[model samples]
Target chain A: MSLRRRDFLKLTAAGPVAFAAAATLPTSAHASPAPDNAFDDAYGVLVDTTFCIGCRKCEWGCNEANDVPRRARTEFDDKSVTTVHRRPDATAYTVVNQIAAPPETPQPVYAKVQCMHCNHPACASACIVGALRKQPEGPVTYDAWKCIGCRYCMVACPFQIPGYEYAKALQPRVMKCGFCAERIIKEGRKPACVENCPNEALTFGRRRELRSLAHQKAVASPGRYLDHLYGETEVGGTSWLYLTGVDFARADLPPLGSRPVPELTEKIQHGVFKNFVPPLALFGLLGLVMASQHSGENGGK
Target chain B: MSPTFRRLAWGIVVLSALHAPALRAQKVQTEAEQRSHMEMMKLDCRQCHTCESPTTTTPCLMACPRLTVAQSSGKHVVSEAPESMVLDKLADQYQGVQFDHKLHAGMAEMNTSCSTCHHFCPPGKIPACVSCHSIEANEQNLRQPSLKGAYHRQCMNCHREWSHDTDCNVCHLPVGKYAQAHDKTDPTDIMGKAHPVVVAPKMKSYVTPYAKGPVVTFYHEEHIELFGLRCVDCHQKENCSYCHDLSKPQAQKKTMEQVHSLCSSCHQNAKCSKCHDTVERPAFSHASTGWSVGRFHSRLECRACHPTGKRISKVNRDCTSCHGGWNQSNFRHAVTGLQLDETHASAECADCHENRHYNLKPTCAGCHDDKRDFKAVPPGKYVTVSRKR
Candidate 1:
């Protein structure tokens, strides 16, 4: 009776092991669908930090357009808020932080922070249920319906942009800059912050064109801008680009390599489970050994 | 037969000898012909040519001095140049901006002159933007902007002040589409229209939140027209958003010290009551300040009497305050609108008046007791009252 029980347990375990091996086969066979090419013609914004005057008009415009409850108009003009470095949160999708310039520079520089909208987003890869997707038009969109209240995207973002609505227990969503995707794609308008910029500090156009323009500006005015165009190559390029007079590190930007974050994770995953043969063969051998043991027990009986 | 051949050979020899000198002279003339006609007029080649014996190949003429010479004295009238100019040096992505040369020149007459735009012009013609600014990015000299940057900076500097619009489409259209889109009217034609007169405000009042002095009245027109001050004189570094942005709150709270700096040059800010008052202050009048800048002093620049680096109101208003030791000998008596006659020209200033106040009517009692009433005799006929003073 014991021998029979052992045989039944081995057979039942083999069924689940075979199923697990087959699940990873398709993913290992093909690479993440060759990162969608839809973002090729997508638009981008070039933020020339030197030109920003720290007026906080972009903050006001964003609040009005996005329907984010805000203080009085007079409160926005209070520039004392820039004394401390602030980040995008549940309430605000974008925030402008003032970076104090060195004594050699004329004035302090203001940098607007928001989602970078990476070309190959790690956030989309981290989502277990396909809740997050990088849109063809350069916006990384999130579907609240598909989300299972997992904050995986928050952890995956290199810029640390995604904010979670922790206060809402019923239906929480990840919040970040959507690049005004709906306004740009459907309404044929520039992003609210970009439109509100009085100084023309933020130039919105096709990503390729803006890249060339950023390079041209840097070349034209040496020393006025740093040699590197931020986001041009970092994290395999991003929709938003930046030009700064001082080092990007001083402006609170993180130094990152050109390789996308998803590339590293995907490469490791694919390498270990190439063709799913290793896991499948190991499980098959394990099941066969258990079956032999059960047959030996039966022979003893 | 031998004698006849000898005579013919002798004739040929004579003709050939004569033509040799003529051929040599023609060769020399051709060599000199290469020299410009102007070069021939200079009897002394050393004046321009550096070398002792200058030839066509090594004339070694002095480098042209026209560039330096033209900087100080070149005066090309606006009408002499083209009415409009198309700046297309860096027009790969955007259509070249149309510059209305005539209209800008006309408007420039108000404050600035032709040199405002023709900054590096030559003697007879306006130089192109590329003349001073290099078309390519010049790494060696980063102080000067490249041609594209230079053009944009020049246009946007002034355009940003008035229109406050920096949209690329405002000044630039897509390449190859501008001409077709503009159709009957060119960019220059639109730009050629005169800018609407920027009306100077007669008065402006600012109600500050300060407890000491909340209200500040600014005599804008008086400061501009009467004081002969330009718009940029006080409004230096003013951003357009200060006036154009309606969504923004009121001007940021400026410290009392910061507000004073703006008027420190002309007015004494120490006197808080001068600017800050409960009611609107009347337009500034010299008479109200105890000394009227009368007809004679009105034409003089404020700096002429006040001198720079000092407040205008702080300077002494008395005539003798500036003209230190005024008497008969050194003083040009006619400047006071009263030309001294032969009788009084040599007379001492103390002879006619008891008090030295020149503004007070002079009493002829000391010099001419008989003509005690000076109304009977004028000092002299005004010496054509030279307005040059």
Candidate 2:
């Protein structure tokens, strides 16, 4: 009878062990489906740098949408404003830097640098406070209340975007280009930057659609541009992709490979941590043996 | 002695013996000792360090006897140092142009060299300036840039002098103060180069009040008309900082009055007609202007609401942009801290209070005109109404 009882316990332990093994496997055969999320919507943008004239209309739209503070002690109507090239600030959520090309065939390339809203956002993983999170609708967004203002997200970000408000003494916030996550993802509309771009330089759509459009634009313009689509496979995939007429190297953008940043780090972490399962199984077996041994000892007494 | 002690002694003896020769040779190096001993032979300095013009023959390879051997033997001598032969040929063929080594070295310090002006001809050949200059203006090297590109790249790139004219005549003039002897055909233009605004003009500064240092002499006048900066071009309140809050004295004290004066001086006068269409001359007469400084609050443009030409004028200051006939329905009362509490006697007046006009019933009689028989409860007269839901 004791041997039979031991067999039953063994079966119970084997069942869980098999299940845990399957869980660690690459295929998610028995795993639960991914949670329904707005980010699952998979929206993106096609930024053709060739078309951008650096008009700064999208900048104004972003400022209006996000309520960012203006910096230069002058009004927007002042023409001398565009002379000084601008970068993304706490108030200006998005900025377009003017990159001057060669003199003879001098064409000014305006590169719009903003949040890439990565598919597997490193910012989301780095945020221990859960302030920065990848929303279900495919946009990495910020929750102001949850942020402790550690600014870890800024450092972890490969793009080195995401600015902090130094002046606001009482309640400062981590300001960044959220793909207008609040308006677009929540309200089901295009981002203010995309909608406000006068030259139609910024196009909003899905990641799949953006890839094809970027490819078509690149192929159509021969010798006019570097035949490469930035961000299609960079840092494992970004919602925002760019097509430029000049070499991207000149723009100081990194040559990121296809592997998602978080996956590489998480893979190593899990490899070390997955020892949990074997230890857990041993514990289960030990518990069963101890319980049976104790029961037999009691009966004999 | 023990074995360990004997081993230690042997180790010390061996170390001393091994280092004895080096220790004997060690001595402080005198300045005379540092001088090149090759001076005893009086060999030409240019033998190793060849300096040559960037013409057909590189400065280093000029009159170099080893160059022939180097070429035949297939040993590589890659350098731009002027060759003694090239210098001799230049002295004979070309006039004595005091090739200022000091100036050229100074220019080279600011502007990078070594690989820029010269190249090692592959298959063991010396690269010359003419090698690059031989290729005519094409897609690769735009037509405007000539061999003068080398000269200009040196001049314009290393030009730390910002106060003077950056024209070619400043440095390379045939008759100018720094002009060398007899290459009157303008050696500055050697390789047929044209200067195309070599150095970018320094930008003008715009004056700002808050700036602690020199006033930012912003070149507004040039950029506006020339760059076609439109009315809405830079009015971007997002990119600039120039607002002043005069309501709170302590907070307002630190605020520069120049911010108000400079901004209002330009903005008030720029397009006043666009804001105030109600009156022709913006009525100087106080009574003719039906607009009250303390009434009719709205998020109207500054020019629209503040019609008075005076520096300071009283205007309704409130968070009633929506309530004052401007149907900003998107605006939330909750944003202004105006959430109503129970008892309906107004939970906190100052919390939602503003200097702007609002149709809030100031007294109980205002709302309950007939219910309270048009009588208002005076100050200190407390009234409470409780209803069980």
Candidate 3:
């Protein structure tokens, strides 16, 4: 009744092979279908760069809401801070950068940088563990418990929005703008930044609606705005749209095509393993090899 | 049930379902037919419906975009429109904003056009903000703003110019606060609402922090009365925060360049000492610079003498600078309140006048000495001229 060394090895080998085989079984019917239109009703914010006066009230509001330590209210009035271009970091979820205006624009144009909250977020796709997720509502949220501190989301983001808690020794989380999901869904309030904007430069609404509004604004004021809306098509249409008088590139926004970041990788992945064929075949071969090893060992004994 | 009975029952149910829409259509057609002959003649069917043969089920009504420009007579718009309105759409968050419609209308007409506020007015009547914009935030169309946002945008457009502060309390009361907290009893009633008349200050003196020239005197009333400058001329692009909401953040210390931008159009910024004087300077007067704009010249525009970009001091003060070759024949002595008689008119030009400066009084000492002075022997008939200065 005692187990032999060879038998024990065979049992251990069979475990992974069997598990792989089971994982590869076809379940197309149960597979959740990709959404027909992910951004149909998702909330979005349209940021009109021309209207932003670089007041930095949004930054102050964000800090106050998120409980980040900041300087006094009077210190926020110092416009000299805008001289340097800044990126979102662990302390700041959003930062406004003043860009040199184009010839058409009368004054310096300011662009707010934050997570775009794309419909098909690359960060979600890049996360090996299900840490980063594109919520049904518009935010690309993070689950710190699931995160392994891989820093893949940071590299995957086209805007380089996600920041890692490199300083934390344990349980580091990826940080980015959450679009005030809790306030919007539970409290029924606007995002702190949107509420604090004096000029109403940022408009919060449904993604689909914001897209058309951005278009209409650009059309209505021919010379006032650049014809293109930044997030309308870039990286499969982000939730946070932008209207700028200058080219988006000049405003420190990355130039990206309309294709979603996950599209190319998903195509290659699905192509290699369509209908659960290739993975199933590999598992089958592994199982056969393990079975042959068990038989060969028995015959030798 | 028998098969034939079951079949007949199903047939009746199917027939009734099919006929329901047809019956409704017939009723609608009758209603359309019942229209008066004159009413039918007035409107073309295509005006409301897209198709030639529109029925109740497939009416194919055209969507009214409501983008047409509104036309209204100026007189009717003022008379028929309400004097004020209570914008209470966002009352849950803040008390209703009482808009003084008449005051704004009058101000807008004088400064801008009526179309500034009545942006989407149709013929005859002013349209409500909701006519174009939706009341609900979740409305499908995003082209126009929600009613709350539209109202704020319209009001802020002009309000921000006078007051830079965007504090909601400037126009609304906090949630639970009574409107009677202020002098006005009813916030909605604007019948007696009037902005306190803005009195022009005679002068404004600024003691600047500048180490060099610290005092700057701005002649406010003189610029309006004497210089004939409108309020908007210097107050262009001013925000409401400029006068209201003093608690708001003070404007940052202005640079020399920023300080000069205000009056650079009229005065030369290169001459900084002119404005930034060490001591509080007196109000600007034409006489302070040596040439006095007398009664006859008070009504003339500055450009008549200074011309474009010409310094005020650069103008010649002598009468001959403007009226060249002014001898007895062409001089029209009657304009001076004394018409010269034939005897004195034929005298040399320098006999009575000390210098060519018309501002100096004419003396007859050179011609007749103390024996027969200008008072003893009148030069001509005296004319009473009402001088404005």
Candidate 4:
């Protein structure tokens, strides 16, 4: 009875704690102490939902600016709100969302949705051929010929701006909004939509200027603004910024802080895989030991 | 035994003597027979020849009856070589063709003989095309390809394609004359009198054989102003063959009147006064009727003078055809305040007027800055400003 009890105690003591330590041994042996930095100038947009007016003037301007085909119904005089608002389709680079009208206010508030060309844009990073690239000024441009329609960019984009032409039998190209990059940068011309707006609503200027303008407009009009410049700090900064007077949370703008998106995943990834150095060193040591043991066995045989 | 042997020997000697001349004659006969035997028919050699020559004429010929008939048929056969039994055997292994008869015969003018294009055997026998056109092909005949390749080479070759002539009158007429001013090489002009072409007895059936004359008058001057016929209406500036054959009709199925009726059916409503108006017709309310036709002559009606919409012969370069007399001219309006300088006059008027639509306002504001919208603006200048601000 005494001998059996001693054997049982010894078995219990040797089991769990030793196994648990072995499980965590490799991780402790090669811990990455440094944080990674792949996102140099990753840019993005923060759409504040509070200040949108559903006037749809932005839509009209966007269509005109992009030289898109005329819609079957575009009567601006009608005030009926539809069950489904507009979406940014193949031709439209931007869309205006019509939120419920403010109390006692006759007109509804609207918000524009377009490419949130991201800082550390997944689309640019995913492009194997370097077809999609985020420029320093915040617009992502594409080289048509280099794209082979692998659709890796489509999967990579958070906003899902890049669309593929599955219907075209030949010579299909990836289509997306380039934020009027050609007109704004090279020709020094305002975007067509910005230029032809009947209302004093749309404006084209430097990103900083736009932020300041949005802030000033909101501050000056006390009841009019929700006191937020959407693209000022969210997801880094976007070339196209927005201003809204409604609750942004209700406007469907995703809640995100100033941290660039790629950093989140890269932090965990680089912490595990540290430039492949630790794993390679361990492999070399194991190989040396295994070789010596194998030779000894072979000699004995 | 000696006597018997002598008799036998004498008999043998007599027999040998008797047969020697006959053998020699036979050998000579055979040589002559080979030379005389009909072996081949060279079709191209007989293109200009009245009839096919017998194969005895050349040792290189492979005698064939089918080739003989084809060779005698004449130069018009498109396949310059004849089809024989040997050719039939080769055709079973490849593609066979009965080429167009007329075009190939046209090469007779080059004075080429059958050997120039045919496959001849060693020591001058007429070999089959397969013998020279196959994997064991010789270099001399290597350039001459298969039957299909040979035909394509001759027909689609760069040298044989028709192209536009760049000579002066060949494209544009001389100066102001609307119709072709002259055909320099015309045989009628060389004789100083038009001589009627002799209708060959064989070709008489093809000459003006159908009874039909041009149906529509197609008054050119009337259409230029009335129907608004541009220069391209009937006259094309490039590739004349692109529209009309100009050589000969491929079909005699339709009569001339049928063709004329078919063509003019679409253009029946197109006439003078349809687009332009005479003084008797309804006049435009704001049209300048009294303006002098400067540089353009004024005596004739619009349709009578410029019969064709196209600009015709050379006219005077000075801008005085109608404006020379100024206030005394038939036109009431004259250049009272200012006249266009050489540079302005030469510039196309439509460059500033925008499009050719007659409803155009014809003002500087169409392209240049609008002066009326803003105060303190010059009459002819424009100003750019933001509407929103």
**B93-149 in candidate 3: lDDT tens per residue?**
567878888777656544535666665433344667776666665345545556765
Which pairs, if any, clash in model 1? none
lDDT of 3 by residue, A1-301 (tens): 3457787678667755554445444422334333235785888899988777676878877887873446455456566777698899877888888887655443456788889998889999999998988888888888878989889889988889988777878776788888888988788788999887756788888887787788877786788888988877787788898998887685568898776887666555664566877567657775876687778878878
What's the lDDT for all of these models?
Answer: 0.70, 0.53, 0.71, 0.47
Best by TM-score: 3
DockQ of each: 0.02, 0.01, 0.10, 0.00
By DockQ rank, best first, the candidates go 3, 1, 2, 4
Among incorrect, acceptable, medium and high, the docking class of model 1 is incorrect
lDDT of 2: 0.53
Looking at candidate 3, what TM-score does chain B attain?
0.50
Candidate 4 lDDT, B190-263, residue by residue in tens:
11222244232311111233224212233444455444554334433222122233342354586656744532
True contacts kept of 3: 0.13
lDDT of 1 at A98: 82
What lDDT does candidate 4 reach at residue B54?
30
What lDDT tens digits, residue by residue, belong to model 1 across residues A175-264?
888888899999988899887665567777778777777887788678788888888877778888899998768555899877678875
Candidate ranking under TM-score, highest first, comes to: 3, 1, 2, 4
Model 1 chain B TM at: 0.54
TM-scores across all candidates? Answer: 0.44, 0.36, 0.49, 0.34
Query: What value does the lDDT take at residue B66 in candidate 2?
Result: 26
Error of 2 at B302 (Å): 70
